[model samples]
Target: MRSPSIAAAASTAVLMTLASASRGQTTGGFSLDRFEPAPAGDAFFGVPSPAAPGHLAPRVHAMLDYAHRPIHSSGDSPIDLVSSQALLRLGASLALWDRLLLSLDAPLAVAQGGDDPGIPGVAFTELTAPELGDLRFGARLRVLGRDAGPLQLGIGGYLFAPTGTPAQYTGDEEPRGAFHASLGGRLGTARSSLGFLWSASGGVELGGGPNRPQQLTFGAAAGALLGGDLLQLGAEAYGAAPLGGDLLLSSTPVQREEAGLNAELLLGAKLRVLGGLTFGAAVGPGLTNAIGTPSVRAVGMIGWAPLPQPDSAERAPAVAAGDKDDDGIDDALDACPDVKGDPSPDPAMDGCPPADRDGDTVRDIDDACPTTPGARSADVTRSGCPDDRDGDGFHDGIDACLDVPGSSSDDPRKVGCPADADDDGIVDASDACPKVKGTASRDPKQNGCPDDPDGDGVRGAADACPNERGRPDPDPAQNGCPRFVRVHADEITTSKPVQFIVYGKTRAQTVAPISDDLLREVRDAIQQNPDIELVEVQGHTDDSGSEEYNLRLSQERAEAVLSWLVAAGVPREKLVARGYGFERPLGDNRVKTGRQKNRRVQFMIIKRKGAAVQR
Candidate 1:
């Protein structure tokens, strides 16, 4: 099944091929095998692992490889494109120092067979004899990392020479080369039970001439060492495409695989029969019908590969590392870097082993009350102690409320003591008016419950003067009030200061007539409240005077006021006077303002409506 038009075109192509071959030249295309193998560790049949086992010393390598039908075609009837070919390759590699590797290989096509159509201009185009392929030499240099480490990088290139027969389709006519960047890494070690490595390369293949297209070449390989380092298995893929030129990763390489992926895949196994002597075989198929990509391929290889001795890093460290804790584990891996203890995985406790003496989860180092079991807390001081929010003697659990101090109670259920809702001494449990702050009372029923927050004994809301001390008054309008020494209130609530003029120096300081008006107001207020109980005229002085002089001076002032009240028809038996030498100051006596308030006479009502309410 051959069309005349296609056969004519094929004949023209053949004539051109013959014309080129006669001059000992080729179209510089269709050379199949691309060999670039790493010099050390494990290697695949074609593309190699980018690893060099050891580089301390120079290492030499040799290989003999045979491939079946690595370059062939199909379905071209009378003009039968070659169906099979046998190839033999001999190669060698040498690695220098820990960086550079050099290699060379020469291949021979032993036999190639295909059909020939009797078309004009193409009569002698069929292949029948053995031929030689191009000669290849290559070199690579380490760019980063230790050659054998898990992340080494390298860059290299291969040079091709026109050393084979042009008729066999195995060589490029013009000198050419390919350059690439390679990356990969190896894990474990040759001495270890297991070792693995991987490599990938990408670069450009130089074109020989106008007829030969420059291609983007790529390869990937992975290999492993097993059977205690005696056996190796690997797989690899290598390809080239002019259409994929340069942008291999950014472009749709996946689409190339679906459409025209020109690559061959190989899987092989190698075994070391003797020291440095490895024998291997591989088989695979081409992914697309590009030049040199065969329908099916098989390869066999025999080689001597020896690894170099590892460097000092593979041995014990030269110097002693710091270990302040004296733990067997190195400080680097220790959870508690400075603490002498076991290792831990947590960074907070790493190297420092977890320890809690009291069996609480809280670490002893951070626990405040180390001996006692406690809850976790933001406060380092009490982290390990029972929760005490308000700082009361009772634990938070027994305390009815948190963040509020409570009193100690006889009741077990109320161990937190008195849970005073208000800041008064009386516990809210006993205080009927819990919200009202008040003083303690002898009678529980009439205690803080009645809301005598001022404790002046004016129970309920009737006491116009709440906080200050007060007494029951005979005046209905101002009953249970404290403040203003006025007749309207019937009690000495407050008034202008009682001014006095003292004349007697040696004779018990006489009260002058200068404070007469102020004294009369006090007398009038007391007279208006006949039902009022005993009233105590308290005198006080600032700290400016000596204690003895202030007491004597204040006593005279209080007695002066008291005598005025008794003279104004007030019962003398119902009144008493006392002088306190700056002892119960209503304000700080250090300042002039406070001293002014201190040097004053106070009419204190020793009176209360509630029998239990006390000053």
Candidate 2:
């Protein structure tokens, strides 16, 4: 019986040749099954590698595995299944920026099963194939991993190298080393890997050994991570047919076929059980055959894929602040954050509704000039708006005749509001003839009417008598003036003023002074004269006292007559005063009674315009 070493080498050589012919064969636990659960940066779950810093994923991984191959063959052929293989892996995933990733897989193995025969159920009586007995290395470079619509695609290539025993058959021809390449991608939760491989298999000739020819094969694989990323379960099947079926040249032409069907069921879990140390396990059972051998494989892996770095990728893009439509527009202050707003000035009001200036109870939108601050009842345009229509600092509605401008008059028709026609500041309705200009007056009936009385040549409106011009005409009608006349003597309208006083004799030295009624009588007489503009008062005193004292006393007496005119609502400017000492007295100052009579006040009339009054 061959030693374990010989057995292992021989078994490995045979497996190697089969493995080469079916380069795309899927191994039980780790051969081209796409153990890379997900491409470094895919959005299978969310933002691929939410753990990768700037998509740079730095990881260290290791795997220990064991496989048992059981061989069987069709009639007329012999089979030897005797190989146990173990492999270890350690590598870093350099996620270069965002676009690419570089990976390396270094494997070390200790394989020892081979056929020396003499063992029960062993299919081979003699071992004659080259067996693999050395370390192997492989590298993967991912060229793309980006969002394409709803799919995340990854394109990459893988290479494998052999550093193991080559010759096992009597006339061995299988090469000791080999290389392979592959591509992969992932969409949603599904992942797929494909590869095309070429290699040399066969050895020297003893009884005409099979030719170790170059061959090409194609394969496809796919998988998915279930539960969370921590637990994954998948299945993959691969098959390959040689590009050229002429693997050997035999003397007789016997149809030779080279093809393989490999299928595996894998279960793995990444347990973050102890801090950063990840305890991962994978077990796979061959379903079809890997290079025509029924094999069972189990892989146990423990790794620390270091904590994902911060400053990873740029902050996942803030959800876009204040963005309503997910479009950024601060609603609190957004005019039209959702939809583009009017390009006009005030962004706030541009998007929002504007304020109305008029108290019209209408909003700016419906209100033409929203800022038109007008009165509530103002006459507005069709849009319920106003624009200083009359330009009178007033709005239209309450503004009587909206178009026609009017002063403070009472004629609502012709005068916008009501002009103080006659400029008297009194409307026609309130004025006797508001249309006819007249100054304001206090007399009820004559408030704004002209004070014209008689129908003589001179208008009673200003004539004193108004019908008569001469002095003391008792019957004014026959004296060129009408019997009844209109008079306006308001403080603001009296044109002229006059005053007069009469002296009376006291019987038996007892005299009654002139009363306010009498003084008013004298004033009325003077007022009736249109020629009187103002009145002057003179007083005389008896000379029975010192000249200075008598003079002062006389002045006091004259002032008494003037006071009556003023109290009658007569303008003081229309009256004047002076003292005529005893020198001007008509009554003799010799007797007491005579002196008292001489001490009296007299009045005279003055003429003035615009100030003229008629009776």
Give lDDT: candidate 1, residue 501. 47
Residue 331 miss distance in model 2 (angstroms): 12
TM-score of 2: 0.34
Model 2, range 562-582, lDDT digits (tens) per residue? Answer: 665676766688787778777
What TM-score do all the candidates reach, one by one? 0.44, 0.34
Model 1 CA lDDT for position 244: 36
Measured with C-alpha atoms, the lDDT of residue 245 in candidate 2 is 26
Off by over 4 Å in 1: 1-42, 53-79, 126-129, 243-261, 308-615
Candidate 1 lDDT tens digits, 318-376:
43466678766566556665776644445566556446766677886676655567887
